[model samples]
Target: MNSGFHGNTFAVIIAVENYQFRIKTVDYARNDAIAFQQWLINNLKVPQENIKLWLDVDATKSALNEELQYEISNLTESDRFIFYYAGHGFYDGGYNKITTWDTHPNNIQETTVSLNRILMEPLRNSRCNQCLIFIDACASYIDEQLVSRDFIADMNTKEFSDFVRSSNYRAMFLSCSRGEKSYGSPELGHGIWTHFLIKALNGEAPEAVERERFITSTSLQNYLSKIVPDYIKSSTDIRGTQKPWAEVSSSNTFIIFEVSGASSEGSNNYIDFIFIPERLIIDFENDLIIAYLRGLENDGRHFLMYDYEGLKEIDVEAYCIRISKLKNEIRKILEEIMDFLMEYEWEEEVIFERSDDKFNISAFLYEDDKTREITVSLGLSLKISGLHPMGDTIFDSEFDVANDELKIYTDSSDYNVEEVEIQEIFSDCWDEIRRYFLLEKEIEKELLNEIDE
Candidate 1:
């Protein structure tokens, strides 16, 4: 469990599942809001008094405005603020407004709460160092009496961008892209976007590199962007319809949540060698693409290394330390992948389990009344050089370097699976495993040069 205390954090969570007017009821909005409030309390350790929750009829235009302004006024420069809404939003009379329980569709401008006034303005004017706005509304609404337009026009316009950029510590995360509906799933028992969000807050989100246990605000956005779309395509018939969006202008990346079971042994000083997309550099003059990890030691001394050999030659102890760290990282990645697969409620009985230091992913495919079962078993193989007294193995291969070497082997399963989706999942996991290794783009460039010659 996350033991971190965020007493300074404040939130206003609003969910309107059943409107007083004859508006179409939003499904599972209340559950999503409640889940989020609980997460703030349980995971972030936010005090209950700091959070104000408004459900159904309690979410009125006047109430919302008063609460928002009150919260904003109470916030200090050192504090953090979060505003969340999961309800119906509409664009009417050239204004984007989130509907209150008492909002009549015919009088949208008067009865509804303007998003600019209720959400953006206060967030901009607040002295808080970090503010997050999560709007799960904006799905197209069906009302015969009123002219309903997509909320994207107001959200994606120039004024909206300016509103986001006005403050350096403000970020807004929307559930879907323009003209796309944010969906709720019966299987997941919450809004599809919020369900994945809860999972991410619970620490199932991958792609975080800076810290193992803490999910930074930037990483949360990136994780939602990657996982939501893929899961939608695989699970729902509306494939490629919903994509998460974020307009982040925060200069500092706030640590949002401390994840459970994230820390591994020797993980504190671990250095990654992966060619992350943002940090990757191409060297045309040298005919190579370079990716490296540079970091400061415990004593504040800095070091840079392009490959394992450099570290091995400079400090054997450091090299061995990295070997242990990478080994644990590889296992952690596989465990996360297994956890992800277990979330799918497949019709065919699928067995996902880990035992004896290996992950077994078994699923059945049904085609034309014929059932075929495929199982992918994953494990690691470690080969240590005879430099240390504890291990010695005689092999045909000859070593060029006299220092110790550690070789880790993954992808032991059969790649030629019948299911294409399973194949893709395996391939993705393999790519994640490959991220902990040396420079890949340089190797690819060298191979291409050889092929060209």
Candidate 2:
């Protein structure tokens, strides 16, 4: 038995496909809810008797009170509850409620179930150890365009940094932040967030460099926090964006499911890597990643990727870590790239050093052997090349040096970027270096903006 689950994990999943009196039906809300129910049964090993699934017409106020709420009330200190609603959510400025099949726009207060009433009050008062709620609908019926994303992870002013050891944990994994919209991926038959979420729950998410298993509140929160939004922004056409929020009361030891057992361990070892698109060649086998994809079919999410675009939503960071390899790992790789560029007769060397600021990395990246070089402070910042007694500030590149990123491994802490991101960041710096060395036409208007693209 998992630490938090001794065959006592119960879920009340509400998936509403059709609305009463023929209201606007959400695109993939029903599908998301149904799939979640199945995933709980198929992947998490939750007993069917422990789950009460209400879909479409079955998801009503009466059903919630008699069935779902009844189940919540009976939960003991050892029990865990998952309350999920994948349908339209009405946020009438202040309060948020789940829009049901019979929910009327005129009388929403009486028609729908207030989210807080169902999950918040009940779980807080109950003896249940962990109560996880997944809401994949929007709060504003007036704001229909921004409806798809409703996963709201909220913490108090200092919720994230504060963790208290508790037998009972209450958290919400919301679809989007308060104002943002959650959009669907046409390639994925279900909602975009739901697609990756199902993958996350299966322990298919990436393990931190330190730990190989993702079974804690912090690990799940960290992985999804990094991955989902990154996937969304990288999409070409999607207009709305979603950033998954979590208000977890730091129960790092709280296990969503067991990973030490043979049944789960077997599948987990094989599904370590996330699905990478065909064109993008980021080597997982050799790169600072031990978690490489064992082919999509063996990984089990192969069913979701019917079209190539489906690869866009796969949360690679959730399941893999990109640690900086043993010393000179980056230098060696850049040297190899330099050797290739030598085929064209232009020499290059990527020299890196810890800068004056402890958090910063300063480097001299040579473009033409030792003759032509640019100083790079941080990964994507270029220090102006110059001969000056007073200062080299005149010709300096003004690109902002954001955060100083390091490739740190983890047994199981929060996930971070790996070799791929670092390479690109420095590569972008190199581009700036080249532009600084080659672009003599500073006389042209808006030279900085020209070099930006």
Candidate 3:
């Protein structure tokens, strides 16, 4: 019987406003809000059954009524509950307050939610193992000429102190250091810190982390530190602070979060091939020949060459080693081909062949490998039967570089002939030819590695 229980659950609440009071001049707050939701759903691997997402432009006291409170209360029984707020925060004389859409700077009491009430009453009592709160509140001081008292206040308070002292499993990440004001820009779609947080979650910076590295909080924090600053500079006006903060429960266990199981081997192979698109055909042909030769070498096979009743010297060991090396190269190329297939969503089978002073390579693509959809082929022949020609008719004028490029020359008069038309055909086939050879080179490198090992 299967013994593993279902993985942990997470709940996220993004509350932008408190009472109906709206704070103006948020640059990318809306986009940040949406990105956070997607990060939870797609990257964080949060289960839908356990997720309760609360999003509002302005969440007033009435809006967060009994029903919303019940839902938020029920989420406490979950494994983890995360609350994220990206709006204005005010400080009354004693308590830290979050502003609603209708809040006024002069009258803080009418449109604000006490931070203590939001966390201690509903969230802390929910019975969750962990509660993480992210706040990007904008607090500023105005002179007495404009307002009776300073609206911005220090984050430290009795309620905050009590929560910190009492809740060991609770953690909080603030946008700015205490006493410093957090600023936003029209360029960044959200607060600078929040922007980086989204990127870290998306697995975009330093490339996405392997599924294995994402299990620990330390790894996740490391990833966040590396990625957030760059994203902030690029997209937002606010710069990230030197010391970002995070808190995790001492007793909490790290869990490996698996995003997906699709192998990355094929993607790497495809990238290598695309890097050197030319030489693909020559490489593939060479690899195949080498594979065949290696098999012969292993089996103690020999090819005898006779010229006009004369016998050539035979060295069996030398041939075996050479073929073995070639076979190794071929195997490497095949590995790359497999990787390329996995990275991209393409259905194609690659084939290689060589005959009578000519090397030919083809790719057959299908909806799936089982059904043939299309066939594209390129051939290199010494006889120039179907060679693409240079426009100049004088053949001896230009020196032809062997295997570097296929070339043909036709006079104005011969251009009308069907043979000249073959030049156009092969010219278009150059891209495929290059790709085949590139694949071959990668295979060769792999073989070299195997031999060394």
Per-candidate TM equals 0.57, 0.53, 0.46
Candidate number that wins on TM-score, 1 or 3? 1
Q: What is the descending lDDT order?
A: 1, 2, 3
Q: Candidate 3 — which residues are off by over 4 angstroms? A: 1-12, 15-22, 45-58, 65-68, 76-78, 140-151, 157-168, 185-188, 206-212, 215-243, 251-453
Residue range 1-453, candidate 2, lDDT tens digits: 123456478998888767785456677777788789887888777889988888888987777656666788899877778878777665543446676778775665678776556656566667776777777765422522223443222212122212222333655676764434566677787777787777677666654111354355545655665576667767635434455655554323355654433343334333323343122222445553333222332334421212222233433332222333322333443344445444555333333433221112323333422335322322221111111111111011122112222222111112223444434433433443344334433434467777886
Quantify all predictions' global Cα lDDT against the true fold. Answer: 0.56, 0.50, 0.43
Best by lDDT: 1
Per-residue C-alpha lDDT of model 3 across residues 121-204, encoded as one tens digit per residue: 676567765566666664535433221111466454335434533554554555643333454545564556677666655554
Superposing all C-alpha atoms, what RMSD in Å does each candidate have to the true structure?
17.4, 16.8, 27.7
For model 2, the superposed segments whose C-alpha errors exceed 4 Å read 1-4, 92-94, 140-168, 207-210, 251-253, 260-453
Worst 10 residues of 1 by lDDT: 392-401
> What TM-score would candidate 3 get against the native?
0.46
Q: How many clashes in each structure?
A: 0, 20, 35
Return the lDDT, model 2, position 99: 68
lDDT of 1 by residue, 122-228 (tens): 76776776777888876443435322213323343234546666776666778875445688888988988899888887776665423565665666777786677
Better of 2 and 3 by lDDT: 2
